[model samples]
Target: MSAKQTGTKNRSPMQYSDWPIEQLPGLSQEEQSQLQNCGIKTTVGLVKQGKTLQDKVALAKKLQVNLQYVNKWVALADLARIPSVGTQYCGLLLHSGVASVAQLAQTPTHRLHKQILRLQVATMQRRDLCPAIEQVQQWSQQARIVLSDEC
Candidate 1:
């Protein structure tokens, strides 16, 4: 399936109550209950915070989840949003010294190629990274244009 189709198809129910919070890592029962109460049950819910640190922190607090956990959810969400990028590849990118979406977007093709090679060595499987790198570059260019327009 195309990435857009996969995204729509993979979407969880809109209601937070429908999420299986028990399956989330490192969440206590109390935290789960609090998250449900605050209308944030799915990982995606936690990741949709507006573009502000305070917003993310408040959301995390309301859900009784750690701020770091919320940050991680956001990072994972961003990686998932990237076409052809998965959690494993995201981890590999981090291990290869690319820690954030901005960093990944700004990375040169040569560096990205080297990182992917390193990841292949660790995983014993080759990953096609060109699509993801191209996507990042496109996103970065668009973001720059938007930011410049705002300024």
Candidate 2:
């Protein structure tokens, strides 16, 4: 049944971020299982459980991964909270220097677009594959919405 039919509002990640952890890029199957073992099977869980530096350090100790790995994973999970910039493009946004949804929200769209374009050209060797300006604008707008919802 649809959310409307169920009397629900179909909230976005801005309100309740909860996508499968596997959907976030770069996590190995083992890592997914490890997180799942800790009852963190979704992005929301990762974000909530790893919110602080101390939490991240504890997670690193439990998962037996580098502190940097846990930090990067938490960042990816945080970015995935933006509905328009979900798992698919969260990594791109990160590599393009967007460390958080708040950053994406405040960044000038054209500048962010240029950064993404430069990274795409340098790594993918194809500017054509870069996201369009319109899409980038949507991400920024959605990020702003997400941030506003937090307040």
lDDT agreement of model 2 with the native: 0.82
User: Which segments of model 2 are wrong by more than 4 Å?
Assistant: 1-17
lDDT of 1 by residue, 79-126 (tens): 433333433344455556665556665777566666667676667765
Task: Give RMSD to native, each candidate.
Answer: 7.4, 4.2
The TM-score obtained by model 1 is 0.50
Candidate 1 accuracy as lDDT? 0.51
Question: In candidate 2, how many Å is residue 66 off?
Answer: 0.8
44-122, model 2: which lDDT tens digit per residue?
A: 7888899889999999999999999998888898888776677778899999999887899999999999999999999
Model 1 alpha-carbon drift over 4 Å, by segment: 1-46, 86-88, 119-151
